[model samples]
Every structure is written in C-alpha cells, then in structure tokens.
Target: MSRRPQLTGRAAVLAVVVCAIAMSLAYPVREFIAQRRQIAELQQQQAKELDALRKLRDRGRQLQDPDYTMRQARERLFYCEPNQKCFVVMDRGKAPAARKPGRAPKPKAPWYESLWKSVELADHGVSR
Candidate 1:
C-alpha cells in the first residue's frame, strides 16, 4: 500500500499541471479584477454626472418660470415694477470716523539744494 502523504508520480504530475494552469491564468485574473474596479469607478462617476444633469434640468425648469425670473431680477438686479417705487436708503446715521494722528515722516531737502552742495564740494576739490 502506498503512503498517502508521499507524493507519487501522478500526484506530482497533477500538482505541476495545476500550478501551470494557475500561472497561465494569473495575469488574466488580475486584469479581470482591475477592470472590475475601473468599471465600478466609472459607474460612480456616471452617477455623479447624472445627478448634476438632473440638478441642471431642474434649474432650467426654474428658469422657464416667469415668477422665478421676476424674483431673481428683484433680488439680484433690484428691478422695480412700473407702478411701484423702490428706494435704496443709505445708512447716513453713522458719521465718518476721524483718523487718529500717526507719526509724520521726516521732510527731505529739495533736489536743487543737494545738487548745489555737490557742485560746491567739486569746486572746493578743484580749488585744493
């Protein structure tokens, strides 16, 4: 009787065949898994785009309504009806705040005075 644990010729051959098949299938199986993940990501992106499209369709519908346009104009453009009067009242109650005194910059000498000083220095140098 053969020992069950000992690898016979047929067992070894079968193990080798199984490993060969697995090796052959490895790249295709990995690619299949990667493609499935990519498909899932694309489906999620499509769902988001569909949701955005639905929102834009709803907005288009809202834009078609005259009341919505009127309301938008009243709020955004400050549009008044022909018979009605609207006034934009300014807050005149608050007076302009006076500025506090800050440090004054030192006054610089006029450009002609500096030029004359340079001329005097050059004349003295020539004289010496």
Candidate 2:
C-alpha cells in the first residue's frame, strides 16, 4: 500500500506561503470595495446634475417667448414702455441720506496728543 508524505520542514514552509498570499490579498479586496462605493456616489451626483440641466433647458424655452421676456423685464429690471410714468416705492426706514462725493478723509491727531488725552481720562477715573 502507498504511504502519504509526512509533514516536515518543506510542507510547513508551503503552508506558511499559502497563508501569506491570502493575507496579501486583503488590502486589494478592501480597495476594490472602496472604488465601487465611489462609483455609486458619482452616479448619484450625475443624476442630480442631469435633472438641473433639464430645468435650465425648460427655463430657456420659457424665455424664448416674447410675453415672458417683457414680463421678466418689467418685474425684474423696472422697464417701462415710452410715455409711461414709473413710480418707485421706497421704504422710509431703509432709505439712506444722499452724501456728496469727493470728500477727503480727516487727518488723524498727533500721537502725543492722544497719549495726553488718555492720561487725562485715567486721572479723572474714567473707564475709557
């Protein structure tokens, strides 16, 4: 009857080699899974971009109509036909007073004068 080979140094070394090869594959397998996840995320982003593009196309088609163009100009740009009086309503609380342009900035006082002012304030027990 034929006899099986005994487990010696060579067989032990072969078993260790097999185990090492399997361990080495772990990183590659993890990287493959990560790449698959990235592909799925990119596909979802592409779908959202395509939907936005469709909406923009629809807006472009709407703007091609003359009535829509005139309405948009009147509402957004305050455009009016010739000989028509236009009244702009302004909120009293938010309106700014008009100031004349070309005014130069005032010059700063000398450093010694500022230091003396601080000293005077300190002597009078002021917090500033």
Candidate 3:
C-alpha cells in the first residue's frame, strides 16, 4: 500500500504566518495605490488651472498695452481716426433695395448726428 503525505506542524505554522502577513499588508497597499492615483489626478487638474491662469495673465498684459487696446477698439467698436470716413458694409440679403449698387448715393449726415444716434441707441440698452 502507498503511504499518504501528512502536513507537519512547523509547515502549517509557517503557512499561517505567511497568510497573516499578506492580510496585514493588503489594506495599506490598496490605500497607497489609491492615494497615488488621487495625487496624479490633482496634479493634472493643477496643470490645467495653471495654463488657464497663464492665458488670462497674457490677456491682461495685452490689455495694458495702448496699441492693443486701440486695435481692439477699432475692430470691436468700429472706431476711426478723426476726419477719416468709415462705411459699414451690410449684408446684401439684409440691406434695403434702395441701398443696392447703381442707386443714388445717400446724403451724408453730420458726424455729430450719427454720434448722437449711437448714444441714443446705447441709452436704450442696445447691444451695438
């Protein structure tokens, strides 16, 4: 008959000790992994915020420049130098038939008249 192997007391004790050590270390290892992931996410968020801050700072610096401010005013507000003629081109589809090409040029109003019209429009809460 073949003899069956039996577990020795020392071997059993060693196996139990190894299992206990692994169980003791598991929670701390999981917590360490989670904390590392959180730190990486926070760093990514911080980098994005820093990029946004840099863009805003650059815009602020541009705003501090008189030439940049003038350019913005000219583009956004349609501002022109004194004595310079400014014409606003309306969309062909939106313009009145009378304003089409080959029609008689409209009489020019005084500059103050147009300025006052803009002021009145602004006072009435018009956007532009």
Candidate 4:
C-alpha cells in the first residue's frame, strides 16, 4: 500500500501566503466597513440639519414681513390696532359651582398678633 503526501511543500507555501494576505487585509476591510457606516450616519444627520435650516430660513423670511409680524403679534400677544376696540371673551361655560352651605374656613389672625402670642407662649413655657 502507497500513501500520497497529503500536504506538499508548494501547497504549504501557497497556504501560508494566502493566510498572510488575509491577515494583512483584515484590519483595512474592517475599517472600510466602519467608515462606510459612519458616512451613512453623517449623511442622515446632514439631511436633518438641512431640513431644520430650511425651516428656519422660511421663518426668517416671514419675520422680515411687517404684515406677518403684525399677525403674529395679534395672535400671540392679543394686540389691538389703535382705535380698534378689541374685547376678550372669556370662557364662562366652565364656571365653578357655588359651595354648599357649611362652616366657613376660619380667617387667620394678623401676623403681629401671632408673633405676640408666640412671645407670650415662650415666656409662659406653655403649649396649647
């Protein structure tokens, strides 16, 4: 019975070369993938920032218009033009119900009277 060599010298050399090449390429490949992911994330953030900037630009343009400013003021600050009678109509539909007849809450004594009472109690060393 004859058995052939499972691994030849040339085959071993080829295998070692392939492993060396793979090891050399591994770090660069991993870094490339990570950089691509970071680029995609940055692109998404840039798009969002561009959208916010566009909105702010629109708001800025609106602010430059006198009529827009007046409208905003009237809506936000309840402003009225001179000689224009503007009455505010409060919501009266949600008025609170009157309390049923019961003992009213006792009114608090004046601060001076409370202070004098505290002084007297301290002098007498008595608690009520």
Arrange candidates, best TM-score first: 4, 3, 1, 2
Q: Write the per-residue lDDT of candidate 1 for residues 43-107, one digit (tens) a residue.
A: 99999999999999999999999999999998888899999998865566887766667956678
In candidate 1, stretches whose alpha carbon ends up further than 4 angstroms from where it belongs are 1-7, 91-128
lDDT of 4 by residue, 19-94 (tens): 9999999999999999999999999999999999999999999999999999988878889999998887677678
How do the residues 19-84 of candidate 2 rate in per-residue lDDT, one tens digit apiece? 999999999999999999999999999999999999999999998999999998988899998999
Stretches off by above 4 angstroms in model 2 are: 1-18, 82-128
TM-scores for all predictions = 0.64, 0.50, 0.66, 0.73
Question: Relative to the unseen true structure, what is the C-alpha lDDT of residue 75 in candidate 1, on a scale of 0 to 100?
Answer: 81
Indicate the worst ten consecutive residues by lDDT in candidate 3: 92-101
In model 4, the runs with Cα more than 4 Å from the true position are 96-128
lDDT of each: 0.91, 0.92, 0.92, 0.93
Candidate 3 lDDT over residue span 1-128, tens digit each: 97756887888999999999999999999999999999999999999999999999999999999999998888889999899898767685685556667878889999999999999999999967
Candidate 2, residue 72: Cα displacement in angstroms equals 1.2
Superpose all Cα atoms of candidate 4 onto the true structure and report the RMSD in Å to 1 decimal. Answer: 5.0
Worst 10 residues of 2 by lDDT: 88-97
Q: How far off is model 3, as Cα RMSD?
A: 12.6
Error of 3 at 87 (Å): 2.0
Local lDDT at 90 for model 4: 70
lDDT of candidate 2? Answer: 0.92
